[model samples]
Target: MRLIAPFLLLAALPAFAADPTPEITRPAGTPQANGVVHTLRQIPEACARIEGAFTGQAAEPYRFAVVRTSQNCQPRARFVDFDKAKPSEAAGWKFNDLIRVPSAACPSQQAVVRVWRKPVDVGQERDGQGQSRIYLDDAMKTAAAGKLPAIPMYAAAMSVEGKACP
Candidate 1:
């Protein structure tokens, strides 16, 4: 009985210390992201296709994006509004860092999730509306919607149009 007590205690020890699983750690730039929430107005020409009641005749779609444009409204070189603005003073809106979203194309479409980012452009202009227009094409829209990587103002300019981004 001299050493039987110590031997029994060692045999009773559990294999894993009976502790919980450890959390998985990720890389620095990569982080868990929240869904993007904002009001999206379809371009007037494309509005009719999107059937829904919005503030204006244009349709409003609430979609998720990997990288969301900042909610803060940044002034475009101090324009009184969109009107009476000079083209030289126009600038693009800065968005949050890249993120993951459910889809990229249309709200009706079920596509693989994607990641994207929108680079700010201070020299791009569209529709002759100066600061009133922020333009993006299908591809750029894909990025803004979180389909691709961070794009420059030039590429993003092709994807989005109107004052939406700014």
Candidate 2:
């Protein structure tokens, strides 16, 4: 009876397997995105609307790239926190890879989900500050909550394995 009981328990147990490699998917007409996470900032005003909030750079130890000051919109060089090859000196806070979801911009609803990981080099976990998940859906909600200028929350959103996350 003991042997049979063990067999039954094993049969009833859920399979514990490692997460499979994510299959990246881009919707039709979605352009190839560079590492750049662009922002629609007021040309002469903000270098970036809220760069520290996104990408991977901390508010400190950061620089601006503005070659043509007269242009309305242009690409700028943003900083990164980690490389998996070259780690950042300021490692207190870091951004996980941008995960594209779906948004209202496209006919198909896809948005992106981004998160902050404080203390990148620390073992296991990080500090609570700047350590919450950021979702494009939430950004949409924020934008919708008020009336005025509506800046885009993300450059793009994608789907993988038929799921709603990047």
Candidate 3:
């Protein structure tokens, strides 16, 4: 039968494959850095809203990281959005916050600077190569912001919001 129909279409092509990209597991005092030093501000009591570091989302399903002081803000250099953020405390190494952006749209500068961290990797969910391996756990449920796919498993990112307030 034509060589068993090409071995049954290559054994059913592994059941159609193509489904395995959902990860973000790395939270437990997450601080192992060859780089991690942050500073930036523009809170001005909220309305200014340009904090610095981490963005939003929390509970369990992780994704956190931010470093866009400028470049017009838009993926200018990249660090994407790590699946949408979650680990702030599912057990241990909780991170995710700061790097605010509002000031009407994008106009940073309340003063305070110190950026330099360039090694990232979280657990097991990489995409497109930019590098993302998220793996942190604990919350069980709560992190629900865009769901997932923003892509940004952390390995370095820490912030402090003080200077500008002076």
Candidate 4:
């Protein structure tokens, strides 16, 4: 029985080594290395009021991404209201002059969202780690602005009037 116990322990050791998990390290502000990078400017009051309405609901889901220009990291923002945003119909478009904010009701005050470099799995570029995340907020006294920081979900984010919202 003693000899059997030692053999069983030795066999289990190999299983543990075979399934080693990769550790994820997240830092403040920008991510280290190839992780997600979110650049949030102070969210304006108008934009925050609009996004607050859809805090819980995923009605106006936006997408954002990071791009490189002249070797400088400059984040680009675009309208990605995929649900209502249609290519042909300007009314469905989030950035068009027709589409107005449900809260502000101002087309000019509307913002744009985007999705950054999404983590690829089993492809030319695969970051076995989980997806990168980002978030956006305003000067509201609400929870979405305070309680739990609403960071952007990995590669997706939104921008309006030059402010980035996760």
lDDT values, one for every candidate: 0.27, 0.32, 0.31, 0.31
Report the number of backbone clashes for model 2.
9
Please give me the total number of clashing residue pairs in predicted model 3: 24
Local accuracy of candidate 3 as per-residue lDDT tens digits, 1-166: 9999999999978855521222332222222121222333322211222223322212211222343444444431223232243233332322333232222111221112222222224344567986754444422232443334332233233332222211
For model 3, the local distance difference test gives 0.31
What's each prediction's TM-score? 0.15, 0.20, 0.16, 0.18
Clashes of each: 11, 9, 24, 17
Residue 120 lDDT (model 4): 17
Superposition TM-score, candidate 3 onto the true structure = 0.16
TM-score of 1: 0.15
User: What are the root-mean-square deviations of the candidates from the true structure over C-alphas?
Assistant: 21.4, 18.5, 22.7, 23.3
Model 1 agreement with the true structure over 10-105: per-residue lDDT tens digits: 886773353222222222222211233332211221121111111121233223222223345342221121123211212433321221222233
Cα displacement (angstroms), candidate 2, residue 56, comes to: 27
CA deviation > 4 Å runs, candidate 1: 1-35, 38-58, 61-79, 89-166
Give me the candidate number with maximum lDDT: 2
Expressed as tens digits, the lDDT of each residue in 1-166 for candidate 4 is 9899999999889856732232222222221111223333222211211121222113442323333233343323332343343333223212111111221333223333332221213222334575443323432444554554322212224444322233
Q: What 10-residue stretch in candidate 2 is worst by lDDT? A: 152-161
